[model samples]
Target: MVIAIGFEGSANKLGIGIVDTKTNTILSNCRRTYVTPPGEGFLPRETAQHHKSKVLEVLKEALAEAKLSQDDIDVICYTKGPGMGGPLQVVAIVARTLALLWNKPIVGVNHCIGHIEMGRNVTKCENPTVLYVSGGNTQVIAYSRQRYRIFGETIDIAVGNCLDRFARVLKLSNDPSPGYNIEQMAKKGTKLMSIPYCVKGMDVSLSGILSYIESRAPGWLDQGECTPEDLCFSLQETVFAMLVETTERAMAHTGSNEVLIVGGVGCNLRLQEMMRLMCDERGATLYATDERYCIDNGAMIAVAGALEFETGQSTKLEDTFVTQRYRTDEVFISWRT
Candidate 1:
């Protein structure tokens, strides 16, 4: 069996996973998250430290759970880019060291492509218009001519980043995640307060909406004009609407009947419901994976990297570098026909 090991430390979470490509099965997935205090965001230096401290333990767990020895690993893969520089560098260094120590070939997988490939593998959705939403990236993608083409994207801050900032404003708990807390609060919201909906043709702008909400949220709560629940509710409705609308448009443009949502924010039930409604209206199918696959994890990197390796793709030690601004469409989708 062709076994691949992947390392991921793009953001706050550090994950390692083993995948058996010949059977399309995940052998093991292990992770550790660097969660900050309420109203605080994780800094790159500290996050990288967390990864450095936990990386070995996580790797050991992954190997033990997979019941595999180092000799059984056919290749090593690491997330190459589209993530925080410090965290990405930590993972790259670990992956590089392991690759050399084990005398195995190494591959650098794009972070966005990892999410897309994992979503497809878990959901079994073929050729769907993908709506990838997360803290660092946002885009509507569809495959064509061996490329995941970007049809729409954020012109400003990402939707998840907007939510995270708002969560800080409200001093929400970061135990699980800021966005999950927002979704829970939104469920209790009875009123839909006015929030700006900024959609620029195919692209969406979220910074303005976040600014408007952040400016009014304090006054709204102090004056009893609205509750935190209401604010969360209004924010979700407005932003998710923009996402759904753009995804629908992409579906129409691509003539695709399938819609797949990936990335952290895509785990929100409200967003899934909104997209499902839209898909129903258009007689299309909505495909989504739960938190396990939606959240950043090493399994995704393994899956994507294994695909590239099986198709004769490998990155030399000198070429294994990371970038924070890797775009979704930049990589050539070699495995896809």
Candidate 2:
């Protein structure tokens, strides 16, 4: 059995996880999130600092939880791209250091593929349409020609970024998360205001919607035209509908009957409910995980990296660098047929 440990700090969350590739089982998954105060968003510099400070602690906790040592770990994995540069660097440096110290082979993984692999493994879905929604990414993908082809994606800001910026406008708490707080308030909302729905072809646009909402938020609140809850509800309904629309289009095009949602925003219950409804309508199965696997975590990286390693893929020490713009479709799928 090959045991792989993964390091992930692509964004605000820093996580370490150990997985056994033979059994497709996660031995340990640990994480720490950097949360800003209400009305504030996390800057890349501050987020990177947070990861640097907490990386060792989280790594130790994961190893202890897994009851494993360097001797037992056969491979080490780290997210290499498609994230904030500083945060990615912090994790990459740590991963490199660990690999050198332990004298083990290392694999650099793509963050999005990490999520896709973990989602498929956890849900046991053979070939499903993937809706990967996160703070920095939003895309509808499917496997084709040994690559995860992107059928649809946001042309402007990502859906999670839109929600987060909107939360800042409302001065929502970032304690647990801005998206989570918005979801709670939306549940209490009784009215749905008219919000713009922008889905162009296979791509969706969310920046304009956020801008439109921001411009009218003060006026709507001051005039008592709508409550915060109502606005949140409207925003969720509109954006999620756009997402569902594009996802369905991809499903139709691919003729896929399974849908798997991944990433931080995938933790939203409302999003899941909408996707579930769409799946039910089309007789497709909807597969998703809770915060553990949904939000960014180390296990996903370990799982993906393990797959890469098993397929005879390993990053040379010279190529262990991180990038901020690694596209999911750029990675060659050596393990997948």
- In the order shown, the candidates' Cα RMSDs to the true structure are 0.6, 0.7
Q: What is the C-alpha local distance difference test score of each model? A: 0.94, 0.95
Task: Tell me the tens digit of each residue's lDDT in model 1 across 23-61.
Answer: 989999898889999999999999999999999999999
Against the true structure, what is each candidate's TM-score?
0.99, 0.99
Off by over 4 Å in 1: none
lDDT of 2 by residue, 187-234 (tens): 999888987999999999999999999999999999999999999999
In model 2, where do residues sit more than 4 Å from their true spots?
Answer: none
